[model samples]
Target chain A: MTAEPDLDRALVQHLADLARLHLPAERLATVLQNARRIVAAFGALGDLPLESGGDPDLQPVRLRTDTAEPPLPLDQVLANAPRTAGGMFVVPRVVDG
Target chain B: MTELWQLSAAGLADQVRRGSVSARDVVRASLDRIERVDPALHAFVDHRGERALADADAIDGARARGEPLGPLAGVPIGWKDNLVVAGERTSAGSRMLADYRSPFTATALQRLQAAGAVLLGRTNMDEFGMGSSTETSAHGPTRNPWHRDCVPGGSSGGSAAAVAAGLCPLAVGSDTGGSVRQPAALCGVFGLKPTYGRVSRYGLIAYASSLDCVGVLGRSVDDLALWLAATAGVDPADPTSVAAAPTTGAAAPAADLRGVRIGVPWQLNGPGLDDEVLATVQTALATLRELGAELVECSLPSVAHAVPTYYLLAMAEAASNLARYDGVRYGARRGEGTSCDAMTTASRSRGFGDEVQLRILLGTFALSVGYQDRYYGQAIRARELLRSDFARAFAACDLLVSPTSPVPAFPLGSRIDDPLAMYLCDALTVPASLAGLPALSQPCGYTAAGLPIGLQWTAPAFGEDRLLQVAGAFAAATDHHSRRPPA
Candidate 1:
């Protein structure tokens, strides 16, 4: 069971970094192994004619009226926030003073 | 001689409407059934008898006041934990939101609740609809009612097991791939994944936004038909939902499939298919033929690649859909780090289960810059070809049939370690999911091991009525659906 060229650990690690997930070295091996098998599963698509006749059109549009509505109460909206301060979500500092 | 818990949604609704059975009686029966069976089955996770009984009492009060009741009046139904119900804990079977409560209700549950369906509680599922077996749930796996050692095929295993074990008359599950249909097959119950966009998905926590749909599980075809009809209309909240022709009316399964054209794909046979499942499906097809259906052989070549196409596309969408879970705004926070990125990554890695993390990485791998065209682009093209194949087949036949699952309810933990083998179980059910067609899994018969075997049928987009009609007809002609698991 060989992995496709791009299904290696380096590629999966790169993908993890891009996706902002923290995968430990041990976990990376298992994830990469399964990812390779996944690639193997769909590898046949590589040879299919690229003639895209139909669009899967992943998302459908909803037509909403122009009417405006009230947003949920600020208190209610922030209730589930893991960290909140001064009526705003408090994320770790991304900027230096 | 049927216990109140054993009645179908329609039967209980009719009885409640006529005052022959009180709503409290129905809800109490469901709660008692849950108490007696759920310890072993683990079908339901978050539940409160007081809340359920209260809601049931309200329905009874409405009846006493001479008010009109919704079609699902007094029907005890379970909502898959992923579907938010304002103020209810919707864990989505993940540790991230294990204690999270919703501020709003999903449109699907809202519609069903409005129609008088009692919320029995939240049913378990594969974390974020990721696994084929319920083994992936953070809460724990839900067991098949037929054999406790086997899985109740998931990610909708809880709902299916609930229905099969007579814990509830109906339950709602989200089907991104074959979640609903596959579990329904394993549990010897009826499950339906409507044509994509046929049901509103406003608050179904997105797994794969494009393919995810609100699906229903029930013991009787009539209940599922009603469940669909009540919730299938377009909603402003879910732009993906379509305003389609109603799904059911005068809802009798046709006496026979006299003029129905059922297409059996040549792809149904092959290496991966189990011998017993193949034989069971063949017997069911023969029954349809005896009912006068014209069975035509069809080809869907792209379906051979459905697993990859479906998984690739689903994983990609899931990767994007799940991005909102960073710990700053919602869900539990996992790590303390100086920078937002550090905290976010730690939270996600700690929050998600192994299966969810693996998919996110695989999805990211497919959509990464250099390989986007090679994997993501080709998978989308594969999707197009699959849709075209379905269209061509439909041009010749009104319906297509396959085994809902390529195998029966397998023993728990058999494929948990091997994700690929577990994913391959979805081979038969994914074709319809990828094509966005309406499909239903009906109990055809059982294997010698006593596990349920499902017979599936796919109808063109918005062909739910036809799917129901045919399933109902078959159910009417056979006693397979009525067989209960021994105590």
Candidate 2:
């Protein structure tokens, strides 16, 4: 598979935004260079046929049954909070509520 | 009284049992060692000297009253920072969790404590166990005991360095891809990566859940064996933990492997392996033959793909596991922002290191919908082939042997620029991890430059007893494991 010479820098920025990372302007060149390397490295995997109607490549995790359990006491939970007010974790208002 | 700090766990335990040395004396000696060497090695992230002494006093008091004692009663052991201990900061070598204390202790740590081992301190590690060298630690790098300028192989570098520097007789480390064995090799000590699920992973900060295994590092194989006996078993809290039978055997009996087949994999003897390392490994093989083990040549054709496969699986898991660090519950918090996205972005941007950020991004791409089949899927297939190769090779041999690392500890910051070069250091070691097999690295010889080289012995899955037996026998015959670099 041919490498995508022109990568979507906007997409890269979008991911950084989603992951909550701040990329210094000067490091953008290095990030893009490294990103290309990674893309090329991962692109090699495209040669393999993964749709072979068999067991998935990843092993199945032995997940436990989900059930409702007693929650920690409000006081104990609050005690761990870095900032709390009025029995609730206080943070900068992100939502109208 | 015997110098408790200098004795192996088995020796110390025996002395305590026979009333030759009190558990309090042992703990005191260990604390003294920490005070002396730790300043130079920076091995311990946090020392619990007061609690350690208190526990030691209790153990001695119990013994005086003729109470039953655990096998490791009064022995001091260091737990890697990634392993949670109640009320202790488990920074995991990251600033994000620099002050994060666990509400509960790790099952393995709890079991060790119950077995009467005094916790010395939490050893430093790669931030979330990411780097091959401990330089990535939010706390400064752990220097190799042998040479101050050199790095002890990392992730578990601190534990290995601490044991080699005589700061702790035994320490626990986690190995996803050679974290335990690599550091032990560079530090000229003994490290054992138990079979997957052999030890509970409930409390270990997940780097790669499926590949991560709690391992032990020590100055002697006997110490490793004793520690393993104390920590290994099924934990109901850890879903992946297996109910395997515990190993039962006497320590360091003069056993011969006259008819045992030892396979030397051709793939592991690859190019670029330092000549001195190869020579040391060759000499070790000859010694094994002299001790009655049959040596044979074997091949793991797919072994070449181990590094790529391991990187994919490990990073993929790391991405998922590290998602919890998003400034939500505990860890470094970003300033309050107008939106939740802004808050998380600011927090992670400030919290994670460059290498960690790079991995997260790479993993995110690999596991993304458009790339999952290409990268993660192919790597998984490669893992299966590597596992089958080991199974096939073990059919003809009781164990496989190779040089643990291509070279002894490289100068610090030597390969930091090239991630690929750094990843190649684990080439020989990752195949075993991928196959979920037990492998041990014991000091075999030193390089011409006077650096330590390690000989790795890997066995089939659930064959830890055999692996330990062989390593113990080899260690008993050589003084390499006992030698320490001049401080």
Candidate 3:
């Protein structure tokens, strides 16, 4: 099955990049092929009369009384960090000149 | 000999409470059953044998001391790998967290443990609950108990197979889009996805946050009720959890469905459904009518679009929820890149399987600029329509009925290459999940090939009691649920 040229293989690759996933060239062909089909199927939503009915309000308000509670221990909080230094999670430097 | 593993959760609990059976014996019997059946089934990935026996002994000791115990005093149960057990490896069936351990227990498991249910182990699942078959698990796929060559439907296949094979009396699995119910249907067991917010989602690693719910699978409706009673309640940890009391009373089997109005959706019976499965569901509906239910025709016109809507919305949420899994956190890390972005990309690509990566890409594309309105916005609107459709249908009927899946369990690897075909298997089950209604799948009958066909009953939110009452009535009247898979 031919992927609709309009869906753009490059665009899907850009999506993979945006999602921070590195898909090899071989997998990209299959991903693009499958994604276009899926996206086209999802296009069925266009058939619905979404113009008249406003978006549903699904968000619920949850408020609690301000009360003092014990916090998690710093060690426990840092327990899962892949890299830690000086009592904090260590990530690659963000501010590179 | 009829072993303790063969008894239902309620029976085990009652016997243990009355001192007729010791908890250690029950645990040992379950452990032995696991040893016998799980070799071919691959239902469990982590074995908590020592802890399970210890916990069981504590139950026996507590009984000796005359301490008060909960109704599920000695029931052995499995926790689907997605739910955390303190210090236990909860991979969510993924290689990313294959070695990651949790610092805390999930609220549902904590509740069950508090209620005296013994944790047998962590069951297998599709990685991050993404696939329709257990084949996606990093550990390995769990096979159906009925026929070892077939898949136990997933991503809750492990829990379903465990219960069906008598490895445990009850197990907890999360249903994002029919994860729990689909597997239960295929495996010929009882599975229930409670009202979305009825059960707490605390420590259930997110699949699709809005749709994910912790569900239970068991051999009998009574056991399902008993398991739900132990776990359902609000938790401060889960803001979405509703403030409803746990449903404690198991509905006794009604002699007749005197006032029950069951609606059958005209859309469910279609070319997509297997002939045998459809006929079995029809017979089950006939049985319900014989039991005095008033069957009415109902239409949820939006249900035909459920798969696309559910995938779009769920994948979008999944993409966002899974962003926390960069290499800097608790999961496996790869690539010694100088830049954080490079490291993250490498880690994720190396960590996730094809299915997970595909969804993330699809979700990213849907949420990207210029496409959000056309895809994400429309999916949300479609969800609203589906939810409203269910509400309107419920107004006309006390409950709705449908075949749990369009077909019985397909052979292993049949749909692995075809993503769309696998997604379509969830056609009937997804409407209930997307609507956040309480739905249960029970063994209505089986096919000539000995494959089970599940009959699903769905009720409006918080209608668990009425839902189980009708299911219990049907189960009490039929012998379908009692047929065990051949040894």
Clashes of each: 0, 1, 0
lDDT of 1 by residue, A43-77 (tens): 77777766664443443334566777788899889
Following a full C-alpha superposition, what root-mean-square deviation does model 2 have from the true structure? 2.2
Across residues B1-487, which tens digit of lDDT does each residue of candidate 1 receive?
Answer: 8799899999999999999999999999999999998998999996758998999999999999999998999899998999998887899999999878789999998888899988889999999999999999999899999999999999999999999999999999989889999999999999999999999998899998778989999999999988987899888888788989886643788999999999999896545788898888888889999999999999998887888889998988888889999998788797776588888888898899999988888888788777777778878888888899999999999999888988999999899989999999899988888888889999999999999999898999998888999999999989999999976
- Report, for every candidate in turn, its global Cα lDDT versus the true structure: 0.88, 0.82, 0.88
TM-score of each: 0.97, 0.95, 0.97
lDDT of 2 by residue, B86-131 (tens): 7678999998888787777898889888888888899999899998
Better of 2 and 3 by lDDT: 3
Residue B24 in model 1: shift from native, Å? 0.8
Candidate 3, DockQ score (0 to 1): 0.56
Give the Cα error of residue B429 in candidate 2, in Å.
1.4
Each candidate's DockQ: 0.64, 0.43, 0.56
